[model samples]
Target: MTSKKLQVIATDKAPAAIGPYSQAIKVGDLLFTSGQIPLDASGQLVEGGIEEQTHQVFRNLQAVLEEAGVTLNNVVKATVFMKDMNQFAIVNGIYSSYFGDHKPARSAVEVARLPKDVLVEIELIASTVVE
Candidate 1:
């Protein structure tokens, strides 16, 4: 069996990974992004409530995807982590606006904590070239 090469991707649009992890990894045509927090391109957390935070997370995803030469359309799956389940409805609403055309497989879970103490985080699995 041949091991796939891990391709690291970086961009100015999302916050840089705080630990020993790439913002996203591309193996072959697939791109797997790290969990994106509510941070801006300059690596600062966005302000406001969960809705705004969710939007920033999506923006970060967009940045990483663009860096990988793909769009949200190429995403096959997504994992959303939230600090509180009560923000589900609001987060879903904002997330819907970002993926206006396609529906990807998704799982949302509430966790006890997140990096930087952000309210929400979003990670994605996408393709380099849309099929």
Candidate 2:
């Protein structure tokens, strides 16, 4: 049996983990990130509606992804947790702007609540082997 080395990914540009967890983890060619809420690097929740919140979440994701040596274009899968499904379209628009033409497999769902009671949270899985 063989085991792949795992590396914790983190950056000060993103909000620090509120609990006992790494911002992301890199194992082999994949980087798995923790769900990112709309908290700023200082760990305060960003103020605004879903649109602003979603954008902040992407910022946090970008920081973690960069720490793992990847980017949104490297993301193969994404899972979005929303407090309101009615805001999906708004979030989708902001999400599209970040990823641009690269579309990754995605799943979105309305959760009863999220950490810090924020409007939205997002997490990603990216490939470290960027071509």
Candidate 3:
């Protein structure tokens, strides 16, 4: 058996990984992205409520996806974590706006806390081989 080399994806447009992890990883046609918080490229968490934070999270995800040569449209799966489930509507609205008509499989849950104590975080799995 042979091992397949995975490609590490990164971009200055997105916040640098906070720990020892790549922004995303690609193997073959699949790209797995790390959970993105509301931090900007400088690694400072954005201001405002869940709506604003959700938007920032999506922005970070977009940058990572673009770096991988994909977009939200190429995402096949997603995972969402929010500090409060009460923010679902706000987060969902922003999420729908970003994803548009392309709905990917998803799982969402309210977590007690998140990195940087941001209100929301999102991660995705996308296909780089867009058909």
How well does each candidate superpose onto the true structure, as a TM-score?
0.93, 0.97, 0.96
Best by TM-score: 2
At residue 8, give the lDDT of candidate 3: 98
Looking at candidate 3, the ten consecutive residues that score lowest on lDDT are 86-95
Winner by TM-score between candidate 3 and candidate 1: 3
Model 1 misplaced stretches (Cα beyond 4 Å): 1-3
lDDT of model number 2: 0.93
lDDT of 2 at 12: 99
- lDDT per residue (tens digit) for residues 43-79 in model 1: 7878888988888898889989998899999999999
User: Candidate 2 at 109: error in angstroms?
Assistant: 0.3
Badly placed stretches (over 4 Å) of model 3 are: 1-3
Q: Tens-digit lDDT track for model 2 on 1-131?
A: 78999998889999999999999999999999999999999999888899889989999999899887788999999999999999999999999999999999999999999988999999899999989
Error of 3 at 85 (Å): 0.4
Give the candidate number with the greatest lDDT: 2
Question: All candidates' lDDT scores?
Answer: 0.90, 0.93, 0.92
